[model samples]
Every structure is written in structure tokens, then in C-alpha cells.
Target: MTRPAATAFPTPDDLFENAPCGYLVLSEDGTIRMVNGTFCRWLSCARAELVGKRIAARLSVSSRIAYETHFMPLLRLGGASHEISFDFLDAGGGAFPASVSALFCPAGEQESSIRLTVFPAVQRRRYERGLLEAREASEVARHSELETGKLREQFVAVLGHDLRNPLAAVSAGIRALSREATTERGARVLVLMEGSVQRMFGLIENILDFARARLGGGIVLTQCITDQLPAILSQVVDELRATNPDRVIDASFDLRTPVECDPSRIAQLVSNLLGNAISHGAADRPVRLSAVSTASGDLTVIVTNEGPTIPPDAMDRLFEPFVRGASSGYSEGLGLGLHIASEIAKAHDAVLDVTSEDSVTSFRLRLSAVRAS
Candidate 1:
């Protein structure tokens, strides 16, 4: 059987003696009927001295004006004044910020007097000022960041558009010479010219992709994570291996744990980590990868390699955009890897972690827990 609720304790007299805040009861005729210790301390007056005294006579002029003209009208009508702020006159006649509210108390068939609650507003004022300052600072920082990002984007756009013409002219000249000149040097020059043009185009595309990701729309999440991960990883590994034939990669995966996530973005994360390991790992050593189900039911994927130590300074900033990884051979495209990984992880509510030492450097992506069913 359920138990009945306990009886309510304490009378009004006891409440005045132990009120959490200042309380003062004034007679309708303006005499102080009763005052709690809290009110006595707030106004810097002793109970013996303040009892039976007139609140209007002792209160600060501004506080008295507000109380009598505005708050008293509301309180007499059986309504309350909500946190009307003013000041009180201390025993030494000093002013202090205060917030007060009052309500009419019932006496038999009629209202007896007003019960006033007072609170010191010093801490509250300070807190409000601090909050205002924090908001202003945040807005300024955001404005500065927006301005800087726009300027950088403009610079990239102008640079790419301006350089395209010069690259075109160079390619046209090399082509014309290869067709007319009968020398072997002409053929090799044409090949080198074509290679240089390709490299320029690749760099320009990377810059564009970076800007797009930064100012782009949200991740387009796919319903499939299980089937997409393995296929994407295999393709990325094959592409990287073909480009760097000297490096050997050993990749292992098991993504049976299904989850809702963006496949291309997830693929971006996988490719970035794997490519990072391939580039940093010793040429003869194997770049290792593993994907398994963690005890917490999330998918735990790790990419590791035996390589030179990552400096403490660089490790802290490794995932930041434009930061060069463990290997300095990276150009513009490579810097966006870890940065994109971070974006993808955040979109999936997953965690991207990195650890590095003398012989072992690893990056892991911790996915959300999948349902057993």
C-alpha cells in the first residue's frame, strides 16, 4: 500500500525567523509590523531599533518612490510587484542595489498589510555584466572569423582564375613545338609541359574543394554505412598503392555493425588516415589498418604505422586545417585530410582520436553504438 503525504510544518512566525531571504511585513498604515533577521541585516538595522518603525520614513528616496507609487498599488490589489529594483538606505545612509516584491496578506475578512521580499542585486548585476561582455566578445570573434574566411576565399578565387590563362598559353606553345620540331628534346618537353599543366589543375581543384567544405552545406547522410565503408576503403587503398608502388599497405576491416552516416564523408575519413599512414610509414615497413566492434557496441577503426615520432607541438595541431602531417612531403590537398575527418566524425556523433610515439603512430575513429537487432 502507498503511504499518505506528511503534514506541512512551520507557522509564519517560524518562517520569518528562518526565511531564505529578507522579508518585512508592513501595516497598511505604514508602520513596520514585523521584520526578519535577513531584512535587518540588508538594511543594516537592529530588530529592536527597526520594529514598529515606518518603512517609507527609513527607505531610500528612490526606493520609497517606487514602493509607494508603483509596487504598493499592485500589492494592495492582492497582486505582486515582480523584482522591482531600487536601493535601500543603510543605517549609515549608504545606498545598495536591491530587488524587491510585495504581496498583500489576509487578515480576517480584510487584507492586513504587505509582505515584502528583498534581494541584494550586486552578484546578479555582476553576472549580467559578465554575460553581456561574453556575448559581445563572441560576436566580435565571429565577425572577424567571417571576414578572414571571405578574404581567403577571394584570394584563392583570384589566384586560380588569373593563373589559368598563363597555364593555357604554356600548354599551347608546348603543343605547337612538339608538332613542328623534329627533335627528341621537343617530344620530352611536350610531355613535361603536359605533366606540369596536370599538376596545376590538380592544385586548383584541391583549393576549390577546401573552400567548398569550409563554407559548404551539411553532410548528406546515407542510409548505408555497412556496405559503403569496405568498398570505399578498398578503392582508396588501391588508388594510393598504385600511385606509390614502393609502399606496401596491409588493410583489415569488418564493418558488420550498421549505422546511419554519410558514405562519401566516411570514405574521406578512411582515405585520409590510410593515406597518412602510407606516406609516413617507412618504405619497407607495412602500413597496418584494423576495424572491429568495440565493447561499447561502436565500430572502432584504427590506422597505424611505424614511423618517425610526431613532435608534441605538431601533434596538438595535427587535425587543424592547413596543418602538415607527420610527413612534410604533403602539399595543399594532404592538409585537408584530418580536417575533413574531423568534420565527418562530428556529423556522425563519432570521435576521431590520434596517438603517436617513436615507432608507432595511430589514428582511430570511434563510431556511435549500433543496435543489436
Candidate 2:
């Protein structure tokens, strides 16, 4: 045998009275029969004021209810609850946020003796305040970042418009000159001018929409039927096919329900997901899309491609700004599409999820159904 177990030393009752933390012993009727100096000072009440008083009588109504509903049971049942938090209001209307913990004990053989303990968490509470401040500062920085990005987009849009107006004029002038020249050289000039004008138009449209969001004018939402979705997607698909002759799009959607959505924003969300998939997913394979209504009045749409498995840890930060996963191209986009799409989804009370395994990756959009109007 190593050594005998040491007997637990017991402190005197007076030692408890001078405890560093607050302490009180209450009767079953909720009368404070004994307390320490720490509690009296912590509550900012005098001994005469706190003596024989009910805990609820001093606390605010909310605190009182919290005590009655939770604390009372915990104490009465001789249970322990830790780190319970609430606000206490003083007589002068000064509110103090506090974290408290309590344990109940029997004084003797009878359960009528209820001993309770409470302590102030000033340091922890101060840390919580610091966290709140940091969160607010982060929000301010995000807003500032968005504002700066919007200014850049707006500048680009304005410049594109100024340049395009002149290009359009020159294209028109070239067409008129081609009509007068009636030669092969004139035809080639007309073709080049028309191609340049079309390219400029597309770039300007994308930039203008991105800039409008910076001014707090987001994509407006509407309730639309599922029937209209196929045609809308077909239009985008046809446009993509014109440039990428090697790629094919497969679209499937359920016809059973309508959804609350902003059509253009929803389209943009899908287009980005699909574009990302096409850029990273296995080439020479079909990129698939499908939508269906759930029994819970939710609509779920999935875009899947047969390529890439994202790492476990990366999934958590995938939607975060500037964090790119294997599913994204090396020089694809600025990492804002998922962020913007996520905001759009929130505006519609929707959810977006990305999952990958082996070489198959899927992005899903889930939206609540809107009543047909």
C-alpha cells in the first residue's frame, strides 16, 4: 500500500461568511437566513437591506422569472447549474450583466435547509463585451469593403458606357459606310465593328448589375411558377452553347410547386454554380441540374458535375470571402459569387449547400415555396 487516503479538512462556518465569492443559505420558504459580505457588496445592498429578503424581491422581473423558473428548481432539487447569465438592475436603473453559478446543499438531515452560492463573472462578462465590439467592427469592415468594391464596379460601368456609346456610334457609321462602299473590305470592317459592339454590350450589362448592389438596391424578389424556369434556363444555356460548342447542358425541374424568388438573382446563383462546375468539373461530361419540391413546402435545386472532392476542413470556409476550394478554378472569379449568392438566398429565406465526394461535386439551392397568387 502506498499511503493512507487523507481525511477532507472541514472549514469553520465563519470561514464561509468571508468567502471570496458570494454565498447565501435560504430556507425552503425562500427567505435568506444567512449570507456573506461578498454577496452584500456584490448586490450593492447593505446587510440590513438584504437580510431575510427574498431573492426575487431584489432582482428585476426578468431575473425574478429566471430564478423562479430555473434557479429555484435547481436549488430546491439540490442540483447544480453553472455559468447562468442575466442582467440585474439597481435601484438607480443601472443594469449590470452578470454570469452566475449555483449549487444547492442540505444543512443537515432535512431538505428544508437550502444552501445557495453565486459569484460575479466580471472578467468573463468583459470578455463577452470585447467579442461584441469585435463583431461590430468586422461588420463595419465588411460594409466598407462592399462599398469600395461597389465604387470600383460603378467606375467600370460608367467607363464602359462612355466607351460603348462611341463604339455604337462608330458601328453605326461603319454600317453606313459599308452600305455606300459595296466592297469586300467594307464587309470585313462591318463584321469587326459589330463583334466589338456586341462584346462591349455584354460586359457593360454584367458590370452595371454588380454596381447596383453596392448602392443597397439588391435583386428584388418575386413569387414565380416553376413552369417559367425551364425556358429561362434554356435561354442562358443556349447563350453559353453559342460560345462553348463542345459543352452540353442537362436541365430537369419538378412542376408541382412555385417558389418565392428573384428570377434574375436565382438565375445568377445557378449560373455561377454551373459556371464553377463547368470550369472545374470533368470536361466531356454532362453538367446536370434538377429541381424538385419537398413535402415541407421547400424547393430544392441541385447542380452536379462529375469532378473534384473538396477537403473536410475547407467546406466550413468555402463560402467565406477569398477562400477558394478545389472546386473553383485557379483564375476563375473573385470569390464573391458564393457570398453574393448566399446573401440572395437569405433574402429569399433559402439555403445553399455544397458537397463533394471522389470526383463528383454538387451545389444545391433550397427555397421555401410561395403560395400561388
Candidate 3:
């Protein structure tokens, strides 16, 4: 039992014939000088047939153009080229993808050869193309979604605008009949009609405001210096009480300072809060509305009611558009009241906040002296 003697370094012929990847050595003018066995096997050709031929003849049409225009120029300038992808033609005229890397080798003072290695890249190229197609499709779908959203907002704006004229005529007819009614039953029926008209008008206003906020950036405010804010808020409460005769609302105001704000927007805000209270508050308990001006020159309005506590999850998105609380459902008008109120408060340079616990729910609006931008 003895060990064999160590072998010498592998000869050039042995190394070139058994190399893993297809290898070629070509003249600077693109004539093939030598090729490895792997290269001949890949193209199903004999060494004698390819040795004296132009290497570019083995490439497919587009690959031949790429090789002549880009790869050859880059190799001449840089002495090397890496990851040049091209399609190669086999003996049967079928095309396969290949990635080539080459280095310039100087054989003499006046002559050079290109030594190249080729790797099969058919599957990898297919995967890269698939990724590009997927990215393009995703971008197209995203653009279509944005366009659809804009169209929907525009349609809502137009619909709200067209509804106002007929609503105005309905109100005019109601007013005319109110003056002519003599019997008590006729007067009651007219009152109900007026209440319905007012409710419809409020719903339309909310829809228009929502459209403006989504399409035109946000709600706009017209600020004016006024001393009649208390009366305006009182009018909102009076209307809600008239419409909902079964509910009792206790409203109190303690303000002595002049306030600057968007009067109409503020009225809308209070009205929304009162409406929310009437819809959700305990029927037997009275809803409370309080407005006070602190000595620090801050105006605050609070609306409170006693009812089932809002779930923690529902409270988080209570002011988001189209997101309703557990108590709000299909009957509510698109769940935009609290959302619009919040936007109005923001336009007035104020904040709308809420708190609920122990069967009591309260929403508060705090307005400081700073004007909205």
C-alpha cells in the first residue's frame, strides 16, 4: 500500500478543454482563433468549422447589432467588457440568451485577442422582463384609480348644485301655503313640511361642503368681526329644538367679549353637534349645550349627552369622513356630520375634540384668537 506521486500543474490544453463555461479567444477583428470544448458543445459545432469564422455570425439579428455597435466599441475603449447580454444562435437555428464578459489580451506588440466567457441567462432575463411588466401594470392601475376618484368628486359637486333650485322652490311653496292656512291641522302639516325642507337643505349643504373639501383642498372661511355670535348659536339650537320636539336640550351661554370668526360656519358646526346629540343621546336624559369665554380670551363650546359608551375602536375614527361610530348606521347621512364639523372648526383656527366615559359623551370646540390661514 503506497501513495501515488503528486501530479504537475494542469496543461493549457487540459484546462481549456474541460472548463465549465463556454470560452472563446478571438482576434481583434472578430475572427475566432480558438474555442473550448464547452463552446463547441453548446453550439453543436466542430472546432474546425468555427475556428476561422467571424464570431458575430453566431449571434441572432438583434444581438449582432448590439455586438457591433455597443459591445465592440466599449471593449475597444475600455480593454474589457462585462455583463453584455445577447442572444446566440445554435446549430438548429434556435436562439438562447447569454451574458458575456471579455478581457483584451495582447499577444504581440502589434496584435491583440479577446478572451470571453459566456453564461446562459435565458431564465434570468425572462424573470427581469416579467418584473418590468408587473411594475408598469401597477403604475397604470394606480393612475386609473386616481382619475376615477377625481371624477366621482366632480359628479358629487354638480349633483349638489343642481338640487338647490328645486329645493328653493319647495321652500317658497311652503311659505306661501303657511300664510293661507286657517285650520289647526293644516298649520301642523305645514310645520312638518317646513321641518322636512330644512333637513333636506342641511343635507345638501353637507354634501357640497364635502365635495369642496375633497376637490378644492379644504373648506374656505370668510372672517368678520362681530358681536352677534351668541345669537347665531342660539338660533341653531332653536331650529334643532323645533324640528325635534320630543327631545329636550338645555343651552347656556356666558360670553361678554367680541369674537371674530366665520359666523355661518360656526353656526353650522353647532348645529351638527346638536344634531348628533339628538340622534344618539338617551331619550330620557336632556342634552346639554354650553358656550363660555374664558378670562384668557379663549372661546369654548361643549355639547354633552348621556348614552351608550362609544367603543374604543370606533372613537378613534369618529371624525373621519364616511366612518361612523357604532351607533351610526345606514340611517345617518353618509356619516359626514362630525367630519364636516371638524373641518369647519379647523377653518376657524379651532380644534374639535371628544371624550366619552361612564355613560357620558361630550364633544368640545376650543377657538383661540389666531386667524386661519
Each candidate's TM vs. the true structure?
A: 0.50, 0.47, 0.77
Tens-digit lDDT string for candidate 1 (190-218): 67667567546545544554665565654
Task: Indicate the residue-level lDDT of 316 in model 2.
Answer: 88
In candidate 3, list every pair of residues with a backbone clash.
none
RMSD of 2: 11.4
Q: What ranking emerges by TM-score with the best candidate at the front? A: 3, 1, 2
Clashes of 2: 1
List per-candidate RMSD values in Å.
Answer: 11.6, 11.4, 5.7
- How close to the true structure is residue 124 of candidate 3, measured as C-alpha lDDT? 91
Instruction: For model 3, state the Cα shift of residue 169 in Å.
Output: 1.7
Compared with the true structure, model 2 gives a TM-score of 0.47
The C-alpha lDDT values of all candidates are 0.73, 0.68, 0.86
Model 1 C-alpha RMSD to native: 11.6
Residue 350 lDDT in model 2?
A: 80
lDDT of 3 at 83: 94
